[model samples]
Target: MSFQGEQHPGVQAPTADSEGFRLNHTMLRIKDPEKALAFYTRVFGMRVLRRLDFEEMQFSLYFLARPEPGERIPEETGERTVWTFSQRGVLELTHNWGTEEQQDFAYHDGNAEPQGFGHICFSVPDLEAAQAWFDANNVTFVKRADQGKMKDVVFVKDADGYWIEVVQADRLGQMGD
Candidate 1:
Protein backbone atom coordinates (compact mmCIF):
# COMPACT_ATOMS: atom_id res chain seq x y z
CA MET A 1 0.00 0.00 0.00
CA SER A 2 1.21 3.46 -0.94
CA PHE A 3 0.37 6.76 0.83
CA GLN A 4 0.84 10.33 -0.37
CA GLY A 5 0.53 13.05 2.32
CA GLU A 6 -2.68 11.53 3.59
CA GLN A 7 -4.06 9.50 6.51
CA HIS A 8 -6.29 6.45 6.50
CA PRO A 9 -10.01 6.67 7.32
CA GLY A 10 -11.12 7.09 10.96
CA VAL A 11 -7.62 8.30 11.83
CA GLN A 12 -7.38 11.56 13.71
CA ALA A 13 -4.80 14.18 12.78
CA PRO A 14 -1.97 14.98 15.22
CA THR A 15 -3.34 18.45 15.83
CA ALA A 16 -6.89 17.24 16.27
CA ASP A 17 -8.19 17.84 19.81
CA SER A 18 -4.66 18.48 21.02
CA GLU A 19 -5.06 21.70 22.95
CA GLY A 20 -7.92 23.21 24.93
CA PHE A 21 -9.00 26.78 25.23
CA ARG A 22 -7.42 28.70 28.08
CA LEU A 23 -8.45 32.05 29.51
CA ASN A 24 -5.43 34.24 28.70
CA HIS A 25 -6.45 37.35 30.54
CA THR A 26 -9.10 39.94 31.06
CA MET A 27 -8.28 43.40 29.69
CA LEU A 28 -9.59 46.52 31.40
CA ARG A 29 -9.10 50.22 30.88
CA ILE A 30 -7.10 51.88 33.61
CA LYS A 31 -6.57 55.54 34.22
CA ASP A 32 -3.08 54.72 35.45
CA PRO A 33 -1.54 51.39 34.61
CA GLU A 34 1.38 51.85 36.95
CA LYS A 35 -0.91 52.66 39.87
CA ALA A 36 -3.28 49.81 39.09
CA LEU A 37 -0.35 47.41 38.60
CA ALA A 38 1.04 48.42 41.97
CA PHE A 39 -2.29 47.86 43.67
CA TYR A 40 -2.67 44.41 42.17
CA THR A 41 0.86 43.46 43.13
CA ARG A 42 0.51 44.78 46.68
CA VAL A 43 -2.98 43.45 47.28
CA PHE A 44 -3.23 40.24 45.25
CA GLY A 45 0.47 39.26 45.00
CA MET A 46 0.36 39.36 41.20
CA ARG A 47 3.65 39.97 39.40
CA VAL A 48 4.22 41.89 36.20
CA LEU A 49 5.04 39.29 33.61
CA ARG A 50 5.64 41.71 30.76
CA ARG A 51 4.75 45.16 29.48
CA LEU A 52 4.50 46.78 26.05
CA ASP A 53 4.80 50.44 25.18
CA PHE A 54 3.02 52.10 22.29
CA GLU A 55 4.54 55.57 22.12
CA GLU A 56 2.78 56.54 18.93
CA MET A 57 -0.66 55.95 20.46
CA GLN A 58 0.30 57.11 23.95
CA PHE A 59 -0.78 53.85 25.49
CA SER A 60 0.75 50.82 27.23
CA LEU A 61 0.04 47.15 27.88
CA TYR A 62 0.85 45.39 31.14
CA PHE A 63 0.38 41.69 31.74
CA LEU A 64 0.40 40.28 35.27
CA ALA A 65 0.45 36.72 36.60
CA ARG A 66 0.45 34.68 39.79
CA PRO A 67 3.35 32.27 39.87
CA GLU A 68 5.13 30.19 42.41
CA PRO A 69 8.17 31.57 44.19
CA GLY A 70 11.36 31.43 42.09
CA GLU A 71 9.49 29.87 39.21
CA ARG A 72 11.57 29.73 36.04
CA ILE A 73 10.23 30.74 32.65
CA PRO A 74 11.38 30.73 29.05
CA GLU A 75 12.09 34.14 27.62
CA GLU A 76 10.62 35.18 24.28
CA THR A 77 14.11 34.74 22.85
CA GLY A 78 14.07 31.11 24.10
CA GLU A 79 16.43 31.84 26.99
CA ARG A 80 15.40 30.20 30.29
CA THR A 81 15.24 32.03 33.58
CA VAL A 82 13.53 31.75 36.94
CA TRP A 83 11.66 35.04 36.66
CA THR A 84 8.21 33.53 35.98
CA PHE A 85 5.87 34.24 33.07
CA SER A 86 2.23 35.13 32.62
CA GLN A 87 0.24 31.93 32.87
CA ARG A 88 -2.93 30.65 34.49
CA GLY A 89 -4.94 33.87 34.77
CA VAL A 90 -3.66 37.25 33.64
CA LEU A 91 -4.77 40.84 34.16
CA GLU A 92 -4.14 43.11 31.19
CA LEU A 93 -3.95 46.81 31.88
CA THR A 94 -4.23 49.47 29.21
CA HIS A 95 -3.20 52.99 30.14
CA ASN A 96 -4.21 55.78 27.80
CA TRP A 97 -2.04 58.81 28.19
CA GLY A 98 -2.76 62.58 28.11
CA THR A 99 -5.63 64.48 29.67
CA GLU A 100 -8.49 62.09 29.26
CA GLU A 101 -11.63 62.00 31.38
CA GLN A 102 -12.57 58.55 32.65
CA GLN A 103 -16.23 58.08 31.82
CA ASP A 104 -16.46 55.36 34.49
CA PHE A 105 -15.30 57.58 37.34
CA ALA A 106 -17.87 60.33 36.79
CA TYR A 107 -20.73 58.84 38.85
CA HIS A 108 -19.37 58.50 42.34
CA ASP A 109 -19.80 60.35 45.66
CA GLY A 110 -17.68 59.17 48.58
CA ASN A 111 -19.43 56.12 50.06
CA ALA A 112 -22.87 57.42 49.06
CA GLU A 113 -23.46 54.35 46.88
CA PRO A 114 -21.94 52.01 44.33
CA GLN A 115 -23.25 53.17 41.00
CA GLY A 116 -22.45 51.77 37.56
CA PHE A 117 -19.74 49.06 37.56
CA GLY A 118 -19.76 47.99 41.20
CA HIS A 119 -16.40 46.30 41.60
CA ILE A 120 -13.73 43.89 40.36
CA CYS A 121 -13.41 40.67 42.33
CA PHE A 122 -10.32 38.61 43.15
CA SER A 123 -10.67 35.14 44.54
CA VAL A 124 -8.88 34.43 47.79
CA PRO A 125 -8.28 31.33 49.85
CA ASP A 126 -9.54 32.73 53.14
CA LEU A 127 -12.19 35.45 53.23
CA GLU A 128 -11.71 36.53 56.84
CA ALA A 129 -7.94 36.54 56.55
CA ALA A 130 -8.09 38.60 53.38
CA GLN A 131 -10.52 41.03 54.97
CA ALA A 132 -8.18 41.44 57.92
CA TRP A 133 -5.30 42.19 55.57
CA PHE A 134 -7.34 44.96 53.96
CA ASP A 135 -8.23 46.36 57.34
CA ALA A 136 -4.62 46.35 58.48
CA ASN A 137 -3.65 48.18 55.31
CA ASN A 138 -6.20 50.91 56.14
CA VAL A 139 -8.22 50.12 53.06
CA THR A 140 -11.75 51.30 53.73
CA PHE A 141 -14.64 49.20 52.57
CA VAL A 142 -17.59 50.93 51.02
CA LYS A 143 -20.79 50.45 53.03
CA ARG A 144 -18.96 48.02 55.26
CA ALA A 145 -21.67 48.18 57.87
CA ASP A 146 -24.31 47.54 55.24
CA GLN A 147 -22.96 45.00 52.82
CA GLY A 148 -26.39 44.22 51.37
CA LYS A 149 -26.34 41.17 49.09
CA MET A 150 -22.53 41.14 49.08
CA LYS A 151 -22.30 40.54 52.82
CA ASP A 152 -20.00 37.58 52.69
CA VAL A 153 -17.81 39.20 50.06
CA VAL A 154 -15.77 42.03 51.55
CA PHE A 155 -15.29 45.10 49.38
CA VAL A 156 -12.28 47.41 49.47
CA LYS A 157 -11.67 50.46 47.35
CA ASP A 158 -8.29 51.09 45.79
CA ALA A 159 -6.80 54.58 45.61
CA ASP A 160 -8.70 55.20 42.37
CA GLY A 161 -11.99 54.25 44.06
CA TYR A 162 -12.32 50.94 42.23
CA TRP A 163 -13.93 48.38 44.52
CA ILE A 164 -12.09 45.09 44.97
CA GLU A 165 -14.06 42.04 45.93
CA VAL A 166 -12.29 39.43 48.05
CA VAL A 167 -14.31 36.29 48.31
CA GLN A 168 -13.51 32.76 49.40
CA ALA A 169 -12.84 30.27 46.64
CA ASP A 170 -15.15 27.73 48.27
CA ARG A 171 -17.91 30.28 48.69
CA LEU A 172 -17.92 30.66 44.93
CA GLY A 173 -18.90 27.00 44.79
CA GLN A 174 -22.10 27.79 46.66
CA MET A 175 -23.19 30.35 44.12
CA GLY A 176 -25.57 27.91 42.42
CA ASP A 177 -26.82 26.76 45.83
Candidate 2:
Protein backbone atom coordinates (compact mmCIF):
# COMPACT_ATOMS: atom_id res chain seq x y z
CA MET A 1 0.00 0.00 0.00
CA SER A 2 2.99 2.21 0.15
CA PHE A 3 3.92 4.55 -2.77
CA GLN A 4 6.31 2.02 -4.34
CA GLY A 5 9.46 3.55 -2.81
CA GLU A 6 8.86 7.07 -4.16
CA GLN A 7 7.67 8.31 -0.77
CA HIS A 8 8.50 11.81 0.43
CA PRO A 9 10.57 12.31 3.57
CA GLY A 10 7.72 13.76 5.67
CA VAL A 11 4.95 11.53 4.30
CA GLN A 12 3.13 9.15 6.63
CA ALA A 13 0.29 6.70 6.25
CA PRO A 14 -3.23 7.90 7.04
CA THR A 15 -4.41 7.25 10.58
CA ALA A 16 -7.45 5.10 11.33
CA ASP A 17 -9.59 8.13 12.29
CA SER A 18 -10.51 8.62 8.59
CA GLU A 19 -12.37 5.32 8.52
CA GLY A 20 -15.51 6.79 10.07
CA PHE A 21 -16.20 9.07 7.06
CA ARG A 22 -17.56 8.53 3.58
CA LEU A 23 -18.04 10.97 0.71
CA ASN A 24 -21.69 12.06 0.62
CA HIS A 25 -21.96 14.07 -2.58
CA THR A 26 -20.50 16.49 -5.08
CA MET A 27 -22.36 19.57 -6.36
CA LEU A 28 -22.42 21.15 -9.80
CA ARG A 29 -24.30 24.19 -11.04
CA ILE A 30 -26.43 23.98 -14.18
CA LYS A 31 -27.96 26.61 -16.44
CA ASP A 32 -31.29 24.90 -16.96
CA PRO A 33 -32.81 22.55 -14.44
CA GLU A 34 -34.85 20.52 -16.90
CA LYS A 35 -32.04 19.95 -19.39
CA ALA A 36 -29.57 19.03 -16.69
CA LEU A 37 -32.06 16.70 -15.04
CA ALA A 38 -32.78 14.92 -18.30
CA PHE A 39 -29.09 14.48 -19.09
CA TYR A 40 -28.26 12.88 -15.76
CA THR A 41 -31.37 10.76 -15.43
CA ARG A 42 -31.67 9.48 -19.00
CA VAL A 43 -27.99 9.04 -19.74
CA PHE A 44 -26.72 7.70 -16.42
CA GLY A 45 -29.92 6.17 -15.01
CA MET A 46 -29.79 8.26 -11.85
CA ARG A 47 -33.00 9.26 -10.13
CA VAL A 48 -34.08 12.41 -8.43
CA LEU A 49 -34.31 11.55 -4.75
CA ARG A 50 -35.53 15.02 -3.79
CA ARG A 51 -35.71 18.56 -5.08
CA LEU A 52 -35.62 21.72 -2.98
CA ASP A 53 -36.57 25.04 -4.48
CA PHE A 54 -35.34 28.25 -2.88
CA GLU A 55 -37.60 30.90 -4.37
CA GLU A 56 -36.28 33.65 -2.15
CA MET A 57 -32.77 32.95 -3.34
CA GLN A 58 -33.90 32.42 -6.94
CA PHE A 59 -32.38 28.98 -7.24
CA SER A 60 -33.27 25.31 -7.01
CA LEU A 61 -31.44 22.14 -6.02
CA TYR A 62 -31.85 18.67 -7.45
CA PHE A 63 -30.36 15.65 -5.73
CA LEU A 64 -29.82 12.55 -7.83
CA ALA A 65 -28.37 9.09 -7.27
CA ARG A 66 -28.11 5.77 -9.06
CA PRO A 67 -30.74 3.87 -7.11
CA GLU A 68 -30.34 0.24 -6.16
CA PRO A 69 -32.51 -2.34 -7.90
CA GLY A 70 -35.02 -2.95 -5.12
CA GLU A 71 -34.67 0.33 -3.24
CA ARG A 72 -37.78 2.44 -3.48
CA ILE A 73 -37.72 6.19 -3.09
CA PRO A 74 -40.00 7.41 -0.33
CA GLU A 75 -43.44 8.85 -1.03
CA GLU A 76 -43.42 11.71 1.44
CA THR A 77 -41.38 14.87 0.92
CA GLY A 78 -39.72 14.90 4.34
CA GLU A 79 -38.82 11.25 4.21
CA ARG A 80 -37.54 11.52 0.67
CA THR A 81 -35.38 14.52 1.47
CA VAL A 82 -33.85 12.71 4.40
CA TRP A 83 -33.29 9.65 2.24
CA THR A 84 -31.49 11.83 -0.31
CA PHE A 85 -28.88 12.85 2.24
CA SER A 86 -28.38 9.29 3.44
CA GLN A 87 -26.84 7.99 0.23
CA ARG A 88 -23.25 8.06 -0.95
CA GLY A 89 -22.08 9.28 -4.38
CA VAL A 90 -24.97 11.71 -4.71
CA LEU A 91 -24.87 14.36 -7.43
CA GLU A 92 -26.41 17.68 -6.53
CA LEU A 93 -27.28 19.93 -9.47
CA THR A 94 -28.08 23.54 -8.71
CA HIS A 95 -30.02 25.73 -11.14
CA ASN A 96 -30.05 29.46 -10.74
CA TRP A 97 -33.65 30.30 -11.62
CA GLY A 98 -33.16 32.70 -14.53
CA THR A 99 -30.22 31.21 -16.35
CA GLU A 100 -32.44 29.33 -18.76
CA GLU A 101 -33.68 32.62 -20.18
CA GLN A 102 -30.22 33.99 -20.75
CA GLN A 103 -29.31 32.80 -24.23
CA ASP A 104 -25.60 33.11 -23.53
CA PHE A 105 -25.66 31.80 -20.01
CA ALA A 106 -22.91 29.37 -19.01
CA TYR A 107 -21.39 28.36 -15.72
CA HIS A 108 -17.63 28.25 -15.41
CA ASP A 109 -16.75 24.61 -16.13
CA GLY A 110 -13.40 25.21 -14.37
CA ASN A 111 -11.43 24.07 -17.41
CA ALA A 112 -10.66 27.46 -18.86
CA GLU A 113 -7.80 29.82 -18.10
CA PRO A 114 -7.77 30.01 -14.30
CA GLN A 115 -8.84 26.39 -14.25
CA GLY A 116 -10.12 25.12 -10.94
CA PHE A 117 -12.35 22.04 -11.05
CA GLY A 118 -11.55 19.46 -13.72
CA HIS A 119 -14.16 16.72 -13.79
CA ILE A 120 -16.23 14.09 -12.00
CA CYS A 121 -16.05 10.33 -12.63
CA PHE A 122 -18.38 7.38 -13.04
CA SER A 123 -17.51 3.66 -13.22
CA VAL A 124 -19.28 1.52 -15.79
CA PRO A 125 -19.58 -2.25 -15.82
CA ASP A 126 -18.44 -2.51 -19.44
CA LEU A 127 -16.08 -0.04 -21.07
CA GLU A 128 -16.56 -0.97 -24.71
CA ALA A 129 -20.31 -1.09 -24.48
CA ALA A 130 -20.37 2.22 -22.63
CA GLN A 131 -18.15 3.87 -25.22
CA ALA A 132 -20.34 2.59 -28.02
CA TRP A 133 -23.44 3.86 -26.26
CA PHE A 134 -21.96 7.30 -25.86
CA ASP A 135 -21.00 7.35 -29.52
CA ALA A 136 -24.36 6.17 -30.80
CA ASN A 137 -26.04 8.81 -28.67
CA ASN A 138 -23.63 11.49 -29.90
CA VAL A 139 -22.21 12.44 -26.52
CA THR A 140 -19.26 14.80 -26.72
CA PHE A 141 -15.95 13.11 -26.13
CA VAL A 142 -13.01 14.95 -24.68
CA LYS A 143 -10.91 11.84 -24.88
CA ARG A 144 -11.74 8.28 -25.78
CA ALA A 145 -10.14 5.51 -23.71
CA ASP A 146 -8.32 4.07 -26.72
CA GLN A 147 -7.16 7.36 -28.21
CA GLY A 148 -5.26 8.71 -25.23
CA LYS A 149 -2.10 7.55 -23.55
CA MET A 150 -4.19 6.56 -20.51
CA LYS A 151 -5.57 3.74 -22.72
CA ASP A 152 -8.54 2.81 -20.57
CA VAL A 153 -10.25 5.97 -19.45
CA VAL A 154 -12.94 7.95 -21.25
CA PHE A 155 -13.73 11.63 -20.75
CA VAL A 156 -16.93 13.21 -21.99
CA LYS A 157 -18.46 16.62 -21.51
CA ASP A 158 -21.73 17.18 -19.73
CA ALA A 159 -24.39 19.63 -20.91
CA ASP A 160 -22.71 22.42 -19.00
CA GLY A 161 -19.32 21.67 -20.55
CA TYR A 162 -18.05 19.96 -17.43
CA TRP A 163 -15.77 17.03 -18.09
CA ILE A 164 -16.93 13.65 -16.83
CA GLU A 165 -14.46 10.80 -16.50
CA VAL A 166 -15.92 7.46 -17.44
CA VAL A 167 -13.97 4.45 -16.26
CA GLN A 168 -14.84 0.81 -16.65
CA ALA A 169 -14.60 -1.29 -13.49
CA ASP A 170 -13.34 -4.28 -15.45
CA ARG A 171 -10.65 -2.18 -17.06
CA LEU A 172 -9.49 -1.31 -13.58
CA GLY A 173 -9.00 -5.04 -12.95
CA GLN A 174 -12.27 -5.35 -11.03
CA MET A 175 -14.60 -7.35 -13.25
CA GLY A 176 -18.31 -7.27 -12.56
CA ASP A 177 -20.11 -10.31 -11.21
Candidate 3:
Protein backbone atom coordinates (compact mmCIF):
# COMPACT_ATOMS: atom_id res chain seq x y z
CA MET A 1 0.00 0.00 0.00
CA SER A 2 3.01 2.30 0.55
CA PHE A 3 4.33 2.18 -3.01
CA GLN A 4 6.43 5.28 -3.58
CA GLY A 5 8.03 4.61 -6.99
CA GLU A 6 7.55 1.56 -9.15
CA GLN A 7 7.55 0.22 -12.68
CA HIS A 8 4.31 -1.51 -13.60
CA PRO A 9 4.24 -5.21 -14.37
CA GLY A 10 5.16 -6.07 -17.99
CA VAL A 11 5.37 -2.40 -18.99
CA GLN A 12 8.15 -0.81 -21.03
CA ALA A 13 8.82 2.90 -21.27
CA PRO A 14 9.54 4.64 -24.54
CA THR A 15 13.14 5.59 -25.32
CA ALA A 16 14.63 8.36 -27.43
CA ASP A 17 14.97 5.96 -30.37
CA SER A 18 11.18 5.63 -30.50
CA GLU A 19 10.97 9.19 -31.76
CA GLY A 20 12.50 8.09 -35.03
CA PHE A 21 9.44 6.03 -35.92
CA ARG A 22 6.18 7.60 -37.10
CA LEU A 23 2.73 6.11 -37.52
CA ASN A 24 2.06 6.05 -41.26
CA HIS A 25 -1.62 5.18 -41.57
CA THR A 26 -4.59 3.33 -40.21
CA MET A 27 -7.01 1.27 -42.32
CA LEU A 28 -10.75 0.67 -42.31
CA ARG A 29 -12.58 -1.98 -44.28
CA ILE A 30 -15.57 -0.81 -46.27
CA LYS A 31 -18.42 -2.56 -48.01
CA ASP A 32 -18.71 -0.25 -50.98
CA PRO A 33 -15.96 1.73 -52.61
CA GLU A 34 -18.24 4.32 -54.19
CA LYS A 35 -20.16 4.96 -50.97
CA ALA A 36 -16.98 5.10 -48.89
CA LEU A 37 -15.14 7.33 -51.32
CA ALA A 38 -18.03 9.76 -51.67
CA PHE A 39 -18.48 10.08 -47.89
CA TYR A 40 -14.81 10.69 -47.18
CA THR A 41 -14.22 13.13 -50.03
CA ARG A 42 -17.44 15.12 -49.77
CA VAL A 43 -17.80 15.30 -45.97
CA PHE A 44 -14.16 15.26 -44.87
CA GLY A 45 -12.51 16.99 -47.85
CA MET A 46 -10.12 14.09 -48.42
CA ARG A 47 -8.59 13.08 -51.71
CA VAL A 48 -7.73 9.70 -53.08
CA LEU A 49 -3.99 9.73 -52.81
CA ARG A 50 -3.63 6.30 -54.41
CA ARG A 51 -5.90 3.42 -55.27
CA LEU A 52 -4.90 -0.20 -55.90
CA ASP A 53 -7.31 -2.64 -57.41
CA PHE A 54 -6.86 -6.41 -57.03
CA GLU A 55 -9.09 -8.23 -59.42
CA GLU A 56 -8.06 -11.71 -58.38
CA MET A 57 -8.37 -10.91 -54.73
CA GLN A 58 -11.70 -9.21 -55.36
CA PHE A 59 -10.81 -6.18 -53.29
CA SER A 60 -9.35 -2.69 -53.62
CA LEU A 61 -7.31 -0.35 -51.51
CA TYR A 62 -7.88 3.38 -51.45
CA PHE A 63 -5.57 5.71 -49.59
CA LEU A 64 -7.28 8.93 -48.58
CA ALA A 65 -5.91 12.02 -46.92
CA ARG A 66 -6.91 15.64 -46.47
CA PRO A 67 -4.64 17.75 -48.59
CA GLU A 68 -3.54 21.23 -47.58
CA PRO A 69 -5.65 24.13 -48.79
CA GLY A 70 -5.10 24.87 -52.49
CA GLU A 71 -2.78 21.86 -52.74
CA ARG A 72 -3.08 19.79 -55.87
CA ILE A 73 -2.26 16.13 -56.21
CA PRO A 74 0.36 15.84 -58.92
CA GLU A 75 -0.93 14.69 -62.31
CA GLU A 76 1.92 12.28 -62.96
CA THR A 77 1.16 8.77 -61.72
CA GLY A 78 4.62 8.20 -60.27
CA GLU A 79 4.62 11.56 -58.56
CA ARG A 80 1.18 11.03 -57.02
CA THR A 81 2.07 7.53 -55.86
CA VAL A 82 5.20 8.73 -54.18
CA TRP A 83 3.46 11.77 -52.74
CA THR A 84 0.75 9.58 -51.22
CA PHE A 85 3.16 7.31 -49.36
CA SER A 86 5.23 10.21 -47.99
CA GLN A 87 2.35 11.78 -46.12
CA ARG A 88 1.57 10.69 -42.55
CA GLY A 89 -1.80 10.22 -40.81
CA VAL A 90 -3.41 8.93 -43.98
CA LEU A 91 -6.60 6.83 -43.90
CA GLU A 92 -6.59 3.64 -45.94
CA LEU A 93 -10.02 2.31 -46.85
CA THR A 94 -10.30 -1.21 -48.20
CA HIS A 95 -13.27 -2.33 -50.24
CA ASN A 96 -13.90 -6.02 -50.76
CA TRP A 97 -15.70 -6.59 -54.03
CA GLY A 98 -19.31 -7.85 -54.03
CA THR A 99 -19.94 -6.71 -50.46
CA GLU A 100 -22.75 -4.45 -51.53
CA GLU A 101 -24.53 -7.33 -53.26
CA GLN A 102 -24.78 -9.42 -50.13
CA GLN A 103 -27.98 -8.91 -48.21
CA ASP A 104 -26.41 -8.94 -44.73
CA PHE A 105 -22.81 -7.91 -45.27
CA ALA A 106 -21.29 -5.55 -42.73
CA TYR A 107 -17.86 -4.68 -41.41
CA HIS A 108 -17.16 -4.64 -37.72
CA ASP A 109 -16.64 -0.97 -36.80
CA GLY A 110 -14.76 -1.83 -33.56
CA ASN A 111 -17.17 0.19 -31.43
CA ALA A 112 -19.42 -2.50 -30.05
CA GLU A 113 -18.77 -4.89 -27.19
CA PRO A 114 -15.16 -6.11 -26.86
CA GLN A 115 -14.01 -2.89 -28.41
CA GLY A 116 -10.50 -2.77 -29.84
CA PHE A 117 -10.42 0.30 -32.06
CA GLY A 118 -12.50 3.29 -31.11
CA HIS A 119 -12.11 6.09 -33.65
CA ILE A 120 -9.86 8.26 -35.79
CA CYS A 121 -9.41 11.98 -35.05
CA PHE A 122 -9.38 15.12 -37.14
CA SER A 123 -8.31 18.52 -35.85
CA VAL A 124 -9.97 21.53 -37.45
CA PRO A 125 -9.30 25.25 -37.23
CA ASP A 126 -12.79 25.92 -35.86
CA LEU A 127 -14.83 23.43 -33.85
CA GLU A 128 -18.04 25.41 -34.04
CA ALA A 129 -17.82 25.79 -37.77
CA ALA A 130 -17.15 22.10 -38.27
CA GLN A 131 -20.04 21.19 -36.01
CA ALA A 132 -22.29 23.59 -37.86
CA TRP A 133 -21.25 22.17 -41.20
CA PHE A 134 -21.95 18.65 -40.00
CA ASP A 135 -25.34 19.70 -38.69
CA ALA A 136 -26.22 21.56 -41.83
CA ASN A 137 -25.21 18.66 -44.02
CA ASN A 138 -27.16 16.12 -41.90
CA VAL A 139 -24.03 14.22 -40.89
CA THR A 140 -24.58 11.65 -38.17
CA PHE A 141 -23.10 12.68 -34.84
CA VAL A 142 -22.32 9.95 -32.35
CA LYS A 143 -21.69 12.75 -29.91
CA ARG A 144 -22.50 16.38 -30.65
CA ALA A 145 -20.41 19.36 -29.64
CA ASP A 146 -23.01 20.66 -27.22
CA GLN A 147 -24.57 17.38 -26.11
CA GLY A 148 -21.35 15.80 -24.85
CA LYS A 149 -20.04 16.14 -21.34
CA MET A 150 -16.72 17.27 -22.75
CA LYS A 151 -17.07 20.74 -24.19
CA ASP A 152 -15.89 21.75 -27.65
CA VAL A 153 -15.39 18.16 -28.84
CA VAL A 154 -17.41 16.46 -31.56
CA PHE A 155 -17.76 12.87 -32.73
CA VAL A 156 -19.33 12.23 -36.10
CA LYS A 157 -19.93 9.09 -38.10
CA ASP A 158 -19.10 8.29 -41.66
CA ALA A 159 -21.27 6.47 -44.19
CA ASP A 160 -20.09 3.19 -42.70
CA GLY A 161 -20.93 4.20 -39.13
CA TYR A 162 -17.35 4.79 -38.05
CA TRP A 163 -16.77 7.35 -35.33
CA ILE A 164 -14.45 10.24 -36.04
CA GLU A 165 -13.13 12.41 -33.24
CA VAL A 166 -13.07 16.10 -34.09
CA VAL A 167 -11.21 18.85 -32.27
CA GLN A 168 -10.37 22.48 -32.77
CA ALA A 169 -6.68 23.08 -33.53
CA ASP A 170 -6.66 26.66 -32.29
CA ARG A 171 -8.31 25.70 -29.02
CA LEU A 172 -6.09 22.63 -28.63
CA GLY A 173 -3.17 24.53 -27.11
CA GLN A 174 -5.60 26.64 -25.12
CA MET A 175 -7.41 23.73 -23.43
CA GLY A 176 -8.24 24.61 -19.84
CA ASP A 177 -6.97 28.15 -20.33
Question: For model 2, how does the per-residue alpha-carbon lDDT over 113-137 read when each residue is reduced to its tens digit?
Answer: 7999999999998888888988877
- Kindly provide the TM-score of model 2 when superposed on the true structure, using C-alpha atoms: 0.86
Off by over 4 Å in 1: 1-19, 75-86, 99-119, 143-146
Query: Which numbered prediction scores highest in TM-score against the true structure?
Result: 2
* The candidate that achieves the highest lDDT relative to the unseen native structure: 2
Model 2, position 171, has a per-residue lDDT of: 69
Model 2: how far is 63 from its true place, Å? 0.3
Clash tally, candidates in order: 1, 0, 0
Error of 2 at 135 (Å): 1.5
> 1 or 3: which has the higher lDDT?
3
Residue 132's lDDT in candidate 1: 77
lDDT value, residue 27 of candidate 2:
98
- What TM-score quantifies how close candidate 3 is to the native fold? 0.83
lDDT of 2: 0.87
Candidate 2 stretches with Cα past 4 Å from truth are: 1-20, 173-177
